[model samples]
Target: FALIHSRWTRRVTLLKRALSEIGIDPRRVHLEWISANEGAKFQRTVSWYVNEIKRLGPSPVAEVVDGQA
Candidate 1:
């Protein structure tokens, strides 16, 4: 997902610990950097995550653990 693509890379060293506090799966999120001028690259990035989520159906990371809020 595009949820953390921006900040994850900037703070990857601390992402997992941060995610643990919020019940999110870092693996299910993707962080990529595409140059602003690289429209094609951006499109491909979007498509990739879209297909990934499609295959994953819905994310269970947040709701499967004893009714996460």
Candidate 2:
């Protein structure tokens, strides 16, 4: 996890490299913005990410998939 400001700027490239490095082929990607001062934003962000991961169904990585489920 990362702070929103530093996170968004590198999100795309970071995810790309991350997936590539881990040998995971991502069918899709998502980016979200939430500032440090925004409690509501942080809550929403976590909720959205949780929902998104659920929608994605499951991951090929067993550990990660099990963690989410």
Candidate 3:
């Protein structure tokens, strides 16, 4: 999740759209609003992201970087 301010919401949407246009899966990029004091929320969000990434296995970008593709 890209933790960002509510005011920057529009920018985040635009960024996701641009990334999608480049062939990247937008679902792999998440936009989440998290406040500075929201430690629990941050932990939960990171944990969820870790599990999701693990389920997806190795990233194609990393594979290409390591010449494993």
The best candidate by TM-score is: 3
Give residue 30's error in model 1 in angstroms.
0.5
For candidate 2, lDDT tens digit of each residue in 1-69?
Answer: 457566675777688678867866553465656567999988887788788778877566875768852
Clashing pairs in model 1, backbone N/Cα/C closer than 3 A: 5-31
- Sort all candidates by lDDT, best to worst: 3, 1, 2
Q: If candidate 1 were superposed on the true structure by all CA atoms, what would the RMSD be? A: 6.2
Q: Which 10-residue window in model 1 sums to the lowest lDDT?
A: 1-10
Off by over 4 Å in 3: 1-11, 14-23
Sorted by TM-score (best first), the order is 3, 1, 2
Question: Residue 52 of candidate 2: its Cα lDDT?
Answer: 75
Worst 10 residues of 3 by lDDT: 1-10
lDDT of each: 0.72, 0.70, 0.76
lDDT of 1 by residue, 1-69 (tens): 366764566687477567766765555667677888999999999999888878866666546655873
Q: Count the clashes in each prediction.
A: 1, 0, 0
- Candidate with better lDDT, 1 vs 3: 3
- TM-score, every prediction: 0.56, 0.51, 0.65
lDDT tens string, model 3, 1-69?
445465478777888798789766556677676789999999999999888878777676777789987
Query: Which parts of model 2 have CA positions greater than 4 angstroms off?
Result: 1-8, 17-33, 63-69
